[model samples]
Target: MKHRRSIELQPPAGYAIETERQALATLPQWFVMHARCRACRHQTPIERRDVIRRCGDTLSLATLARRLTCRGCGNRSGNLLLLEKLPRD
Candidate 1:
């Protein structure tokens, strides 16, 4: 049988206690769910199907990326805000 879980997403004070403990250092768990666009300063929602993108600048690389492009423009950027890892196929 498949297990089902529901997650609540509310900005500012979104993350739950358990999720907070699972995070590294001081980073919040909701970071993976809320994505923002630099061009428009617009916030984009992250879906489980969205694939993680990497930067072209290799030397300055800091971490794994999971942002998508702006539907308004051709730009591909976002600050992933919320996410819940789904079951693997």
Candidate 2:
């Protein structure tokens, strides 16, 4: 299956994303985060289902990053890469 990205949903960097209970509100449920922790060089793709269940839209990426610990080496902080959506085939 092919995919098309929805770039407009991307949140601005440097500023905190503001929302009551919906983090990344602009993004759809299919959106996922490919995060790489710079400290331990660990990387993983975070599923939206898990994100919503854990943070429930009340969290920001910055806050999430702070809370995440490198599963590989227990390091903190990482870079988040939002994957583009695949078009329906």
Clashes of each: 12, 7
lDDT of 2 by residue, 1-89 (tens): 22366454554463333323335555554445666777666788777668768777656655665566667877765444445455544
Each model's lDDT comes to 0.41, 0.58
Give the poorly placed runs of model 2, Cα more than 4 Å off: 1-22, 78-89
Model 1 ranges with Cα > 4 A deviation:
1-32, 49-67, 77-89
**Please, what is the TM-score per model?**
0.32, 0.55
Each prediction's RMSD over C-alphas, in Å, is 10.0, 7.5
Model 1 Cα lDDT, one tens digit per residue, 10-81:
432443434323323344333345455667767665442232232332211113233355665556754334
Model 2, 78: alpha-carbon shift in Å?
Answer: 5.1
Error of 2 at 87 (Å): 5.4
Model 1 has an lDDT value of 0.41
Considering every candidate listed, which one attains the maximal lDDT? 2
lDDT of 2: 0.58
- Candidate 2: deviation at residue 50, Å? 1.2
